[model samples]
Target chain A: MTIRILTEGELRSCVDIDREAMETVASGFRGLGEGRAVLPPILRLDVEDANGEMDVKTAYVPGLDSFALKVSTGFFDNHKLGLPSLSGMMTLISAHTGRVEAVLLDNGYLTDVRTALAGAIAADTLARRDAKVAGIFGTGLQARLQLRALALVRPIERALIWGRDPEKAAACAQEMAASLGIPVEACAEGSAVCAEADILVTTTPARSPILQAEWLRPGQHVTAMGSDAEGKNEVDPQALARAERLVVDRVSQCARLGELHYALEAGLVEETQAVELGDILVGKAEGRCSDEEITFCDLTGTGVQDTAIALFAHCRAQARGLGAAIEA
Target chain B: MTIRILTEGELRSCVDIDREAMETVASGFRGLGEGRAVLPPILRLDVEDANGEMDVKTAYVPGLDSFALKVSTGFFDNHKLGLPSLSGMMTLISAHTGRVEAVLLDNGYLTDVRTALAGAIAADTLARRDAKVAGIFGTGLQARLQLRALALVRPIERALIWGRDPEKAAACAQEMAASLGIPVEACAEGSAVCAEADILVTTTPARSPILQAEWLRPGQHVTAMGSDAEGKNEVDPQALARAERLVVDRVSQCARLGELHYALEAGLVEETQAVELGDILVGKAEGRCSDEEITFCDLTGTGVQDTAIALFAHCRAQARGLGAAIEA
Candidate 1:
């Protein structure tokens, strides 16, 4: 058996924020929600002494020929050593023989792409058809990708970016405007952007809430994808309580560790009110019943998405002959 | 960053059952037992439809320069398709930058070696110094490996082999006798072998207890390395209850999933009675205070062992220039 190796640059050249990838991620969620996928709870290790942590996420979706096991690490203090904070690779294994078939050393670029695609999936399923103005918080890699992803699902032509560091936010707007072919503005205040946004995305790792309930509008849709780990909250608990429809990427995870943990802890929202994003795609639950309905999605990321994107990347890499295969 | 790829053949040539590798595994356990290692709980995914399962194991020993994430899969029904029952690989990553360092496509060879070394560690610590007659149950790879490992710790001169298949037992005895330079006897009954043996090792996947408490003799040290998952037992619960000293690879794990679970479930053993194997290695606890004491150790396997073995293989491969490093 031989294993394919795709480098970060190779994966970036083959994988992009596109419609097919978004649909593939959507189907992955549907597989989980429809009871055809086996997703184990994430295994996380915290190396507090080194100010680092690692998470292993995996899932087996029956119809897929392969499954992926992704090991992602976050060394928060790596920046001091001139290293990236996030680094990871995915190992794709054949379902039949359980042998590894490919290793994607994307350094977390594929993770960012799949995560952004999941945001597109949520928006395509819940956001209003004519949603044009997007308000994005946190001007990081995810912030840039999410805006581009939102454009694929909604008619988002302009975006207002906000960050704790105003200079970074302004730089993000200028780069996104040039790359995405849209007018991007930097907002001095987060609330100012939230007030005019047809769709809102909160992508900050904050101990306290960054987006409040009062900033929400009737036709606005919100995608909160930042508060994945415990004790991290991006959207206020009251925002979920006041939303007409509250959805989560995975109910099993969000209820315990994601943003919903705080919402459930504060007794602002009942667990039953949070429908799964997969259920909406699989026609098991209603999504965006009316354009006036305020829809919110809490995405903590899921194993199924990793498997979907990894398999997709492998297929694309093989077709383009973009990776090297070493026979073992 | 690039990852070094070591095939199964390459890793096999580089890694072996030796004093240095065994010592490395011992230090890993010591790190865990001394609270200097971050070992995460195993993440297991069960694919009932495909009759397959996968486990993700990893650990961080602060003293080690790198950590490993091992993805092992067990597809029992794969034999029908002419494939092995278990397949796996270990990915070694940098502890400082969390970058990919090497991938050992060992095909479960390293896992078996580390597991066998753990058996040796248990025997070296808890077994009597004069243990010369080893009684082994099972005719699989682990049975052969454990016997070789036992020779490293004790002055074994002979082995009594017992198996469900008598033909396999006879074959095992013949092969072991020729290779190990020891007299090996094939016993028709398990009781017969257990009666005269100084050291006993159970390496089968039997669901129910195979080694009876009545067969255990004084001064005998038994290592149960089979029962890793819930509801799997190799030694009878009564045997553990009757032992003078009981040690577990990991108390938190063995208490819930290892052979100790059955002993605890039978209400014959207290959780506190099961000391960690590393505790004895680190001199924090006594191991076999008397030659007459019957000691038992449960080896469910842990992430620390995987990390240690992976690092050992990576370093050996690098020194020998046995692997190919592809720049990412």
Candidate 2:
């Protein structure tokens, strides 16, 4: 048997946060919404001594010839050792023969790309058509990607950034300004950014809520993509209660590990009140009912997205003949 | 990051079913017995179209520097395509860093070695000291390995083989006779094999009992290693009730998917009556107490065994510099 190996650079060269990639990911959401995909719960492993954890996510979509199974690592103390805090790889297996087709050593790149695209999908379906200002939390890799991704869907003219470190936030703002050719500024508090922007995306790994309910204004859409694990929350539970509409990537997962977990814990949200982004994308559920409605979407990330992004990466890399192939 | 890829031939050249290999797998049992290993439940996915299923098992032992995550495939229809019914690979990651250190593309070779070694460990700990004859059920790769592994510790001078097909059983017996320098014969009845042999092993994909309770004679020991999934049983549940001592690889796992599941359903076994193979290995529980006592062990396999065997293979392959390393 022959298996292909795609390095991070090869994958980066083939896939980008563009329209084709967005549509590829949108099909994944549609598959999940239509119940044509088999997405299992995350298999998690914890290495207590190193203060690191690994999450294994996978999904099988019959429409695709291959499915992606991802292993994502979070070593919180790796930065002290001059290594990045996040590193991982994805494996694609043939849906027909049950053999591994390729291994993508993306080191969390595909995860970042797919995560950013999910934010754009959420905003495109829920945000007002004329929304121009964006607010971003966390000055990490995702912070920059989220802003760029938003610009692709909405008329994002400028953005406000908030982070724990003021200098890092300012640096991120300057970097985004140069990349997007839009005015960007660092905000001292998340509340200020939340109240002023038309679209707000929280990308921080905060254990406590960063945005409050009172800060949520009408004609605004919020997407929380950072809370993919337990004990991680970005928006206040009261905010979920106050929003005119609440949506999630997957109701079962969000209620267990995302911002919706806290909202459910506080009895501020009902299980039935939540709608899925997949359903909204396929027009099975309403997204933005009115321009004055406050919309909230909590993304815990799903295996369907991984399968979509990995399959897309494979096709692109094969077309370019960019990855290494080995016989087994 | 650098990942070493070891082909099946490279791995086979370095490791075998020797005493050192058994001890390596033994340490895994010790870790689990002492409550120092973190083993998560298997993540399983089913592909209906291919008539196949995938099992992902992993474990972290604090005493080991590296842990193994294994993905195994069982495609029931692969033989019709001139391929093996089972295939898989294992990945070893640093316990301290949670990084993918190496991928052993053994294509189920490592699993086979570890599984056979588990059978040896069970027989060595539970069989009579002077046992000289063995009875093997099934005519698969595992049936042969179980016999070869049993001889490493016992005075096995002769063996009886049984299978659904008489020609395959005869061929297996001839093969074992040539390799082991012992008298091996094909038996027509599983009951006759069970009643005569000092040690018995069942290694078939049987959905019903193959060995009856009345056939279980005193001074005979049975090791059933084929019932790793639900709806597979080799020994009658009544045999479990008749045996003087009942052991399992892992109590909770066996209770859910092994022979113990059927026994528990039939009210022939009690949850508290079962003892673990690890506890037996560590002297925490008693093994065969007398030559007249009948001992039976049900092995459904464990992730700890994978970690132990994979770490051993990685060390040997690295020492000999037998694998290809890729920098990412």
Candidate 3:
């Protein structure tokens, strides 16, 4: 019994997830919403030590016959030790046989990619067809991935970047302009960027409201990707309350971990008020009702996304014959 | 961020799982019974395809700062395909950071060893110290491990083996006699071996009773390591009713996936009737009461054992400079 083990580099060489893979994952979202599969509860562990804090989360999605177990650690104090605050590895296992097929040592790269891809999927289904302007808050890895994914899914003419660090925001704009082939400019304030864009993406790890309800324009699609943990909020509760359509990757997950957590806590929304992203993907619910309707997609990430990406990677790796073979 | 990948051969060379490491794991069991640690639920998947039937069970133990995810598949139909079905890997992750620290491609060998060691721990705490005769049922990998573990924890002077295959049982007896320097014989029937032994170990995959109540004697301790899944049983429920005391690895797990599962279902024993094996190890409960008590220890494997062995393997691999290093 030999199980093929694919390492980080090997996986990178073999996996070519372009627009096609993103579409497949989007389809999986629909399957998930229809109850054709099972996405179990996410398992979490919080570790506190002299080196700071780290949260480990594992998600299991049964339908894809695969589960992606990711270990992400945030060592806030690691900067002093000349190490990044975050590091991780994702193991893709066969749900059918429980054989670990690949070890993705991408730190947090895949998380960023899958998360942004989910946002892109939401944009594809919910954003206005001619969505021209994109607003991005926070000049982080997530911000970059969101921009790249949005480019793949929408016709973005320009991007507005806003961050706490003016220099970093400027650098992000310049980098995106060169790498993503888009015209991007750093805004003076978060609200300035939020008000001018047709699509908005919040990637800040903020505890307080950064984007207010008044700043959001009608028909503008907003993706709240940050504020996934408890006590974390990027968008104000008023924004969620005012949105005409409240869509989420997973209702239960969003209620606990996404921006919806705050909305529910503030009595602004209930479970019945929310529609799953999958429902809209499958045309079970309306995405953007009118040109002037406010819309929001709260994505906390799901195990199904992990499973889809893993399956995609596995198939691609096998096709390319990239991984090393080991006898079991 | 670099992660180490340990192959089976490399891991075997690095892991110094002699008596000392086993003793440490034995000591950790005390904390398990005290409720200071948690062994989460095991996830199982059953696949019956052209390749035969495969049962994959993953056990998660959070206290060891790790989880043991093991996969075992039965390839009874693999003869036609010229393949073996019962093969899989165990992944050990660091609970603190959720980093997959090591992957053991042991094909269930480690699980067998850890399970047997756990049985040894139970026998050490529960079995009479001066027991001279040991009886084992089913000639398999688990049976060998159980006998080896029993010898490690008791003063066993001889071993009696029983299996459906007379040739396999005779071979097992000869192997044990040569390796352990103990008097060994293959019994014609299960009752014959059970009646003559001071300590009994059953490691079969039978769905019906293999051991009878009438065969058990006073001052005898029986360790049933089989009957881990739903419809698997080896010892009679009446035997459990006759036992003076019953010990289990985990109360909840035993009630769901061990010999206790049947006993509880039969209404012969309740959850409270069973004591954790860890409790006995920590002296929280009595083991044997005089020389006339019939004791039973239901041995369903736990995730803690996986974590212990994985950690042991990781440390040893690091020390010996084994396994390939890949960038995370």
Candidate 4:
């Protein structure tokens, strides 16, 4: 009956953007595809006065003993007050007794890691096997974590960074080159990112298309993990139509907020053309038919990822004796 | 940032079934009626294996500094193992920064208090000014709380308790008589309880109508607070058709899961016939027009009440220095 409370620093000590995390998320997707999971639509509350939005996401995977209910808040104006714009906590409930067992005060750390791992999962499932070049569009924490995650699954040896702010992208490039021990360059033209990189990830918060359909080439795999909202579009709608294969985290969600939403709106690509990452992971649908075929994946975050990552981090924290267990 | 954790005992010490608590929940409804509150649709996760359901409810009221995000779980089979069927916790988030301020581990104590008070609000507004006898249909905790709450707002000299189990109802009646210092009687006939009581509250789990419309009379007000699922009904739909005034916690929710749902499905009442309790609380809609009017208010509950009650408890707990604050 005691509930464990784990902090962000403690979770960061155990859970990382690694292979274990990838498979943890991959297992949730497998359950989703195999039809053994229950994922409810996200509950979102928006406050116009504070420019804030709080999203509640959760899912139940049968094999797992407990489910994670995560409350994530994003107050866009927090930066002006010297506070991080995003913060959240997760409550893990026992499936058998329906009692809460733990409170994860990760403050969005688990979310950041899980999101990065999902990007890696999409790339590992859809990208060319011998793909060595990695490129990302955002110069932020996700930009660094995604490439680092890609290196864990793909044979990524060189990387390119693209950003609206060239200085930030250049700084990101230098950091990635030193940390990853690979050749990382800040590209001046966006088309070069679409053309040269075997694996391209758009991590920006662009409202309009940053990656164009005309710039894409054969054998290229695109993973757009940048933004998710009704208005967020990183790649052109036509870009999805240009790819030989299109994949999504969830077709239903992506059809509403992901790249496929715009594609379906413009009559460029039908929703049926896109296969979910879960279906591919479970072999229920086809992934890459050939290395020569272009692939594109839109990454809109899911509740199952949160549940899987939270449970994984909770287990690690418990094993390491890193959290406080108050018998309240 | 720090999160204060308050347990059930601490919450009960400060928050109670009283006038102050009534006003706190009343203010939330007023804000909701004034069109300043933001309530998101509830998110639910069902686990068929365990016969469990996890419900997440939240709301944002502009004037309240923090809004509450509540996670409630119900596992029906837990009683076999000597556990309560329902358990939950509420997290209060700062509306200014969207930061976690406290976690109220009330374990559904706050929900019970708020729910009972909502029944009082309905009775106080719609019941006759001369209401002296309060009757409830269930023999559980709510059966007692509703009468206690009604006593706060009305001049009640006696109370009636009705249930499927006559022995349990008689025991509850004796216990209530000793506690409330009122003449309490457990009646075998549900029709007798309906005919004698001026204010009636249904808190049962019965699937069929326990209160018949043929027995209802003028100058009587009914508060049906039991069972919120699709198939549960404690009062007949025809009873609503007979009522002079009809009120609901929220029309959208009532249309889907409340007594109004059943009434609408039976084509006995129109959706527009039911006015929100908030509207009456804020003077946006009319309540009881005459002493001879038969009023029925359906209380399916709302997120605003959670936000209000949690905030009230947090403020009192802070004033009394009652919780453990962890700087995680």
Candidate 5:
């Protein structure tokens, strides 16, 4: 057997967050909800002394030719050494033979794009069709990617960016506006940003709630994407309780490391009450009941997403001969 | 960063179950027991419809320069397709930067060697010093590797072989005797094999107990290398309970997927009663207390072994200029 290795540049040149990719991710979520996917709980290791953490995730979807094993590592103190904190590689294996097929050394670039595609899918399925403003919390790669992703689903013409560093927020807003041809503004007041936007995306790794219930408005859809670990919070428990409908990428994951964990601890939302995004995609659950109802989705990321994206990238790379093939 | 892709042939040439490699694995176990290693619970995925199973394991030792993420896949019916039943690859990451260091596409070759090394380490620590006759219970790759490994620790001049198929057992015995320059006999009776052997290794993936307490003799050390899954067992619970000293590669793993799981469930042993092999290596636990005592070790394998072996293989390959290096 031979295994292909795709570098970051090659992956970027072949794959993008577009309609087809979004549809693939949406199908992954559907597969999970429909019980056609084997996704195990993520394996996480924390090296407190080194300020490092690593998570390994994988999934096998029936009828798919291959599966993916992703190992993502984060060294919180890497910024001090002028290196990015997040990096990882994904290994793809043949489902039929259980042989190594490809390895995507994208340096978490594909993870970012797949995650953004997930955000877009949530917006497409749950947000208001005529949503004009997308509010974002955080001024990082995800903040920019999420806005670009939302525009593909809703008619978002403007964006409001908020961050602890005002200068970073302003700079990100300017860059995004120039690139996406959307009017973007940096907001100092979080509540004001929430009040004006039809959709809000929380992208900060905050331990405490950053988006309070008092700041939420009706007819808004909030996609909280930052809380993928325990002790991480983006939206307040009260805000989640106030939502007319609460959606999650996966019920089991949300109960452990998502916004629903905090809401569950506060006795605000019952585990049975939360809807799964996959169920919504598969027509087993409702998404947004009405345009005037506040909706929240806790996305703790799933192994199926990694599998879908990795398979998609590998197929595309093979078609275009974008990676180097070596002996296995 | 660049990642060197090592093929199975290159890995086979560079790594073997020798004294140095066994020592490396032993030290890894010690690191885990000393709390100097970060090993998360293994992430396992099973596609029941396809008879496919995959496990993702990783560990970070504080002083190690690199860590390893090993993805092992098993497709039980692959022999029907004229293919090996198992295939996998290990990705080595630089601990300080979390960047890709090398990819060992050993295709489970390294896993087999490391597992054998673990068995050898158990025998070296728990078996009697003058153990001469080594007993093995299978005719597979692991069965051969384990006997070869045991010869390194003790003066195993003879091996008693037992298998359901006498022809296969006879063939294996002949091959091992010719290669290792030892007297190997294939015995038709299980109890007779156990009675004549000083060190016994169980290497079959049997669902029920193959070794009974009634057959065990004093000064005998049994290494149960099978029973890595929920329903697989190599020895009877009664046999384990009767052992004077019980040891395991990892306590948590033994409680869930090893022979100790059955023993604990049968009330034959407690989780606290079994000692960790690493603790013994680190001088925290006792190995074989006396020559007249029967001892048993459940070898379920661990991520620390993967890390240690992968790192060792990568370094050796680099020094010898093996494998292909490409941009990642």
Candidate 6:
């Protein structure tokens, strides 16, 4: 039997700022919403070694005929040893023949990109079209990707950055301002940024609500990108109560792993209240109703995204002759 | 993050075929029957590009901390491309953080071994105490592995081989006899050797029943190793009726993908009539009620086996310093 092997360098060279990935994922989401494909299943592995903590997850999406299985080890304790906190690889297998088509040593780079792209697509559908200002909380890699992806979908002329680390937030603002060709300022307080921005993006790994409910303005849109796992929250529960519209990637997954978990637990939102993002993408449901209505999109990330990104990466690599081929 | 990369050669050196892999997997079956660990989930990939074929598979057991997601791709048309009909890779990921630890390019060798080990373990429990004669069907790699694994668990004095191709069967008998230090003869008729054998193993890829109900004798133990997917059957459905006891790896999976599928579909047996192989291994169910009763152990293979074998391989490789370490 012969199998095709695509290495990490090849995969890296093949992937870029993948608009194709975003579009493909969006289409996959639409398919999921339309009940055209099966999302294989989610498998979780909890790792407890001498190295702090981490969780490995594999999500199967059948339509792509591929599975994007990610293994990310959290060695937060490794930082004291001068090592990175997380490291992992994503393996893309041919859904048809079960041959591993690609091995990506991305160090979570592709995951970050896909996640950010989802946020961008969500913002494109849920955010007010004429919104001008964007407020981004958290100056992490996710925060950067979210900002860049938001800019791709919205005409954000200015961005307000806030983080626990003021120096890091200032640096993040400067970098975003220079790279995006937009005005960006470091905020002294989270409430100030929340009040000024028309679109608010929360990217922090906070266990409690960081944004206040009273600060939210009508007609504004919010993208909650963090709080994916259990026991994680970043938005005020009241924020969900105030929103006129709520969108999620997967209703069940969002209710369990996304921001909806807390809202549902607190009885702030009912099970039938939230709509899937794909519903909005395919026009099965309303996204933004009026300029004065507040909207929120919660993303927990799905296997469909992984499958889409992998397919896009494979095609892009093949077209550019980016990957090395190995005989099986 | 650093990931370990083990090539075929390195993996081979790291694994202890006799004691580590086979024995550990056997023990895993026992553990599974006792409900000690969770086996990885089974995933199917349907190949539409090449031809209409599906790879049905399950990840193995004993991989609580590190799971080797087993994927097998069936390309029945690969012969036209000068390739084998099946190809796939086993991806091992850290259980702690979900970082992919290694990819073993075994080309289904590991799968064959683990499956054969299951058969061997079954034979250890159900076969006659003084078994002397062995009959094997099929001249494929699985046939070879089954014979080898049987030798590890039994003291066979003579062997008989039968296949669709007389020449292949004769060659298989000759090679196995020389290597195993046992007398082996190629039988002209399929059931000629079955009448006198103490243990019979069927390893064919036949889509219809190849073994008849009358071919078996009293005190004979049958290990049906083929019939792993839907629409594939190697033993006669009536043969299951003859067995006093029928054991399977997993009742649910076996009913769907093993010889039990045919029997159940034919209304020859029901879920209540079949027993799991793990049950026998853990002594929860009886293997052979009496020496004179015919017994059949259907081997459908499970994800628990994959996890067990992969974990054993990884540990062995680490101990022997077999795999190369790559930067993540």
Per-candidate local distance difference test: 0.92, 0.90, 0.76, 0.91, 0.91, 0.77
Off by over 4 Å in 1: none
Highest lDDT scorer: 1
The residue-by-residue lDDT of candidate 4 on B89-196, one tens digit each, is 999999988889998888889999999999988888899999999988999999989999999899999999999999999999999999999999999999989889
Model 6 interface RMSD, in angstroms? 4.7
Chain A TM-scores for all candidates read 0.98, 0.99, 0.93, 0.98, 0.98, 0.93
Q: Which lDDT value does model 2 have at B323?
A: 86
| Higher-ranked by lDDT: 2 or 3 | 2
Which ten-residue region of model 1 chain B has the weakest summed lDDT?
B45-54
Please compute DockQ, using alpha carbons, for every candidate against the native two-chain complex: 0.74, 0.62, 0.23, 0.78, 0.75, 0.24
Q: TM-score of every model?
A: 0.99, 0.98, 0.85, 0.99, 0.98, 0.80
> Who wins the DockQ comparison?
4
Residue-wise lDDT of candidate 6 within A1-328, one digit each (tens)? 3233455666666675546667877876887777655554445444334343433444444455666555555655666666567666566766555556676667666777788998888888888889889999999988888888888877889999999899999999999999889999999899999888989999988999888788899998999988778887999988988999988888888898888998999999997999999888888898898999899988887767776776777677668765444434
The ten-residue window of minimal lDDT in model 2 chain A covers A93-102
Cα lDDT of model 5 by residue, A164-270, tens digit: 89999999999999988989999998897998999999999999988999998889999999999999998899998999989999899989999999999999989
Q: Any residue pairs clashing in model 2, and if so which? A: none
Error of 5 at B257 (Å): 1.5
User: How many residue pairs collide in each prediction?
Assistant: 0, 0, 1, 0, 0, 19
Residue A18, model 1: Cα distance from true site in angstroms: 0.7
- Compared with the true structure, what per-residue lDDT tens digits does model 1 show for residues B279-320? 888888889999999999999999999999999999999999
Q: What is the per-residue lDDT of model 2 for residues A1-328, given as tens digits with 9 covering 90 to 100?
A: 8888888888988999998998899899999888888887888888887888888888887778888888888888887888887888888888776777888888899999999999999999899999999999899999999899999999899899999999999999999999999999999998889878999999999999888889989999999999999899888999999888899999999999999999999998898999999999888888888999999999999999999999999999989998777776
**Segments in model 4 whose C-alpha atoms lie over 4 Å from true places:** none
After superposition, the stretches of candidate 2 with alpha carbons farther than 4 Å from their true spots are none
